[model samples]
Target: MSPVLQIALALGSVVGLMGFMAGVRHLAGTWQIGSEVQRKLVHIGTGIYALTLPWLFPDRWPVYLLVGLTLIVMLLLRLPNSRLGATLHSVERQSYGDFLLAISVGVCLFLAGDQLYLYVLPIAVLTLADAAAALAGSTYGTKFFRVEEGEKSLEGSAVFFTVTLLISVICLMLMTSFAPPNIIVLSLMVAGFGTLVEAASWRGFDNLFLPVGLLIFLSAHGTSTLGELVFLAAIFALSIVAFKIVAPKFGLNAHAVRVYVTSIFLLLAVTDPQNTIFPILVLVAHIWRRSVAPCDSKFPDLDVVAALVLVSLGFLTLGKATGPTAISFYGIAAMGMLMGFCAIAASASRPVVRYPMVLALALALFAIREGVVRLNPDSANWNGPMWPAVFICVALTALGPMILSRVFATHRVVKLTFLALLIPLPYYVISTGF
Candidate 1:
C-alpha cells in the first residue's frame, strides 16, 4: 500500500485500541482506580499504543474510522458523568463560529506544514513538557523550588526536561540520519534548543508553543522525507517512555536528589556536545556527593541557564540557514533577549506574571511578524523576507522594562509596556491569513 495509507492504518488501529481500553475499564468492576498510578498507566499505555499505530497500519481509512469510533465511545461514556456531560452539552450548544477560528488555524498549519515549523515548536513544548511537569510535580514533588513567578519542584523540572530531551533527541537523530551530513548538526541543534524552550515555559501554553515552535524550526531547517517520518515516530515512543518512567518515580522522594543530579548531567550533554567528558565528570561527582548534598534548598539555576543557551543556539542555527538578512538576524536576537528578560523578571518578583503567559505573548508576537512577512508580495519566496523583526521585538520587550526601570524608576510600567507589545499580534494574524 501507499505510505499515506500505511500511516492511516497505523493511526486507526491505535485509536481503536484506546477506545477498547476505555471500554474494558468501564466494564470491569475495578473502574474506580482513582490513584495517580492508575491514571498514569492508562495515559502512558494509550500514548505508546497510539504512537505505534501509524507505523503498523499506514492506512488512512482505518485510522479515520478508528478515531471516529473512539470519539463516539468517549462521548458515550462521558455522557453519564455529570461534569463531562455538562461540558459536552455546552459544546454541542455552541455555534459553529466558535470552532471556525480554530479550524481555520488548523487548516493553515496543515497547508504550511514545513513552512511553519519554527512557529509550531513552542506549542509542542507547552503540550508535552508542561503536561509532564504538572503530572510529575503534583505526584512526586516534595521540596519546592521557587522561581520568580512561582514554585516548581526540582523533580518537576527534571521530569519535564527528561521527557522533552528524550523526545527531541530521538526525533532529531532519526531526521538527521537521512539528511545531508551538513544539515544533521543543525537539526540536532534545533531539537536541543526546542527542548530548552519547553523547559523554561510555564502554565499550559507550552502545549501550544512546543509543537508550533518545532514546526517553525523544522520548516526553516528543512527535513528529509523518510527521516522526518521516522523522527516523528521516535517522538511518540520517547514521550510514552518518559511518561511511564517518570510517572511511577513520582513517589520516590528518596531518589529526588539522584534524579536531579542525573538530569543535570544529561542537560549538560545536550547543551554542549563537545564537552561530553564534562557530563561524565559531573555525573561521577554528583553520585559521590549524593549523600552529602542537601536536597531541601532548590534546583540550581544553572539548568535554566543551559536551557536558555540551547534556545539561543537553535535561533542562531536557523538564522544561519536563511543567510545574513539584517532584519531576520536582528529579530531573532531581539526576541531571545526579550525572553531572557522575561525569565529574569519572573524569577525575581513574587506574584509576577505567569511564565506561560509571557511565553505565549512572545510566541504570538513572533508568529504574527513571520506571518506578516510571509504575506509580502515582492518576495519571490512565499516566506517573508528574513527580517530580524522577532529579534528586534524580543530586544525591545526585554529592554523596555530595564529602560523603564532606569528612567521612570518604577517596574510597574514594565507590565504595561509588555501589554502594549501585544497590539501587533491580532492585526498581523488577521491580515496574514492565520
Candidate 2:
C-alpha cells in the first residue's frame, strides 16, 4: 500500500476515537458540569492522536482522510438526533457559540501555515489560562477585582497568568525542537500578553487570539542572539517590577497603559527594525481602556501585576528567538482588546436579550473584518489561500451564533457554541502536515 493510504487509515482511526470520546462524555452526566475529568480525557486523547498519527501512517493521504472523517463526525455531532444518540445528550444549552468560534479561529491559523509552537500556544492559553482563572476565582478569590463591567477577580487573573506562563513554557519545550536560550523570557512574554488580552477582553475568544498573537511575535523575530536576548530579558523583568510598584496609585487602567508603553519601548530597542505592532497594540489598548471608563470601586490589584509579569516574560522569551512585525502584533492586540470588551459586556448583560445581541455584533464584526481582508489581496498572505478559508469561516461563525440565539432562546447556547468552535480544531491538527 502507498504511504498516503496508510496515513489516511491512521487518521481515520483518530477521528473514530474522537467521536467515541465525545459520545461517551455526552453519556456521562458530567458533561453538564463542565467536568474537568471529561475535558482532560478529550484533551489527552486528542493529544495522543496528534502526536502518534503521522508516525503511524507515513503519507499525506491518511492525513487527508482523517481530516475528512473528522469533519464528518463534527457535522454529525451538530445534528440533534446524533447528539441524542450519545447518552440522551442532556448538556445545558449555553452560548456554546464561543467554542465554535474558537475552533474556527484555530483551524484558520493552522491552514495559514503557522508553526507548531504557534499552533499549540492559543489552545494552551484557552485551556490552561481559562481553567486556572475559574478554579482560582471560585476557590481563592476572596476580593473581587472589578474592572469596568467585568467580574474577573485579582486572584483569578493571577492564577490565569501563572498557569498560562507555565503551560506555554511546557508547550514550547514539548512541541518544538528549537529552544533558544531566551525561551524562558519569550514564553513569559507571550503568556503574559495572552493572559492580559484574555483577562481584559476575551469575550471568550481568547482561544483564537492568543496563539495567533504569539505566532505574530515569533514570525517577526526568528530568535534573538544570546547577549542581546539577556539584556532584553533584564529590561522586561524591570518593567514588570515598575508596573507593580506604581499600579495602586495610578489604578489598574493606568497600570495597564504603563505596561503597554514599556513593552513598546522594549520591543523597539531589542528588535533591529522596529516592528510597528507593539506600538500599535499599546495605542489600541490605551484607547480601549479609556473607552471602558474605570469603575468606582477599589479592587485588589494582584491579578494586574501577575498579568504584567507573565506577559513581560513571554515577550522576553520570544524576543530572544525572533523579531515581530508591527502589523501582526498590533492587529492581534486590537483583536484582544475587542474580545475582552465583548466578554465583559456579555457578562454584564441580562443573558436573555443583551447576550444574544452582543453575540450578533461580535459575529458581524468578525464577518466584516474577514470580508475586508479577503477582498484586499495586499492584506493577505501571498502563498496560502487564507482568504477563501477565512471567508467560509466567517460565514459559518456568523450563522452559528445567529441561528442558536434565534432558536435556542431559552436554552443556554454558550456551551454548544463553544463545542462548535472546537469543530475546526481537529482539521487544524490534521492539516498541520506534521
Candidate 3:
C-alpha cells in the first residue's frame, strides 16, 4: 500500500479505536466496572493494535504520523472538561501514561525499523504484562510493599514476572533461531528485567520505560551466556539493595531510588561500566544536596529523580544511535549539569552561594569523569568537544534554576521536568560540532 493510503487507514483505525474504547468506558460504568479496569481496557487495546504495525504499515513515516496525531488527541482528551477523559483519566493517580504510551509506540517503531520481533516483543511486554500486573495487584493483591508514593503487592509483581516470562518465551521462540536453553535464559532475563522496571515505575511512566528498556536490554544481551546473565542479574540485585540502604542518607525517597537504580542499571547494560560512574556520583550528589537544604511548608521540594531518568535515557539513546564515545561523555556531562541544578534548587534559600557551589560541583564532576577515563585501561578515545560540552552543560544548567525562580519561587515537579527535557539540547548542538 502507498504511504498516503497507509496513513489514512491508520488514522481511521485509531479514531475508530478511540470511539470503541469510549463506548467500552460507558458500558464499564453501567456495569459498575472500576476506573482502573476501564483504563487498562484502553491500554491493552491500544497496545494490541500497535503490535500490528510491522504488517499494517510497512513504512516508518506512517507510524510516526499516527503517533503524532494520537498524542495530540490524547492531550486534548486529558483536559478537565473533555468528556472522553473518563476513558483514560478515570484513575485518580496523576499519570502521563497516555502521553508516554503514544511516544513509546513512535520511538520503538522508529528504532525497530524492519526488525519485526524487536517491535513486537517490547510492545507485547508493555501491554500484556503491565495490564496483568495492575489487574492482579488490584484484584488479588494480598501482600503489599511500598513503592515510591504508593504500595505494590508481591502477588502483583509475581504475576507480572510470569506474564512477562511467557511473552518473552513466545516471542523469542517464534522470532529468532536461538536454542531452547538460550531462549529460556533470555526469557528469564527479559522477564526479570521487565518486572523490575514495571514495579519501579509509577504514574504510567512504565508505558515508556517498559518497552524502551526492554528493547535496549534484548538488543544488547540477546546472545549472552547464562553465566553472563546471572552475573549481571547479581549486580542488579546488589544495586537495588545498596540503593535501598543508602537512599535515606541521601534524602532520596523510595521512588527516587527506584528511578535512579533502574536507570543506572540500564546505562550499565549498554555502555561501559566506567561510563556510569560519574552519573552515579551525580545521582548521589544531587540527592544529598537536596536533602540538606531547608524544608518549606508552603511548597514541597521538587523530586528530580524522574528528570534524571529522562536525561539518562535520552543520552543512552543518543550514544547508541550515533555510536560515538563522545556521546557517553555527553551523557555524563548532562547528568553532572543536572546535579548542578539540583544543588542550586536545594539551596534556594541561600541564594548567595548557589552559583559558586554549582560551578564547583560541575568542575568536580568533570574532574571525576576525567579521572574515571584515565583509570580505565579500556576507555575509548576522548573526544575534543567533551570538556566544552561539560562547560556548556553547567552554564546552561545554572541558568535554568534562575529562570525558574524568576517565574516561580517554589519548585514544582512538572516545571523541573520540562526543564530536564531541555538538558540535551546543548549536546545535540555540540555533537553537530564534533
Tens digits of lDDT, candidate 3, 316-348? 555546555444454545454455446555556
Model 1 lDDT tens row, 260-358: 332433333223332232223222322232233222223322322223333333333333344432223323333443453453354333434544555
Cα RMSD (angstroms) for every candidate in the order listed: 14.7, 12.6, 3.7
Residue 141 in model 2: lDDT: 85
Q: What are the per-residue Cα lDDT tens digits for candidate 2 across 1-434? A: 68756865766675576676767566566536444334434444444444443345444355545655655555565567664223212323222323433343334234324365654565556555666676678677887754434556778878878887887778777776646555676676766666565554423334343444455555554366556655655775686677677655544554354435444543454343323332343244334433343322232222222232233333333333233212222222233333333333344346696557656755664564454345534432222433443434334443443344443232212322332234233333334332
**Local distance difference test, each candidate:** 0.42, 0.47, 0.72
TM-score of 1: 0.37
lDDT of 2 at 148: 35
Best by TM-score: 3
Model 3 RMSD, rounded to 1 decimal:
3.7
Query: TM-score of each candidate?
Result: 0.37, 0.46, 0.86
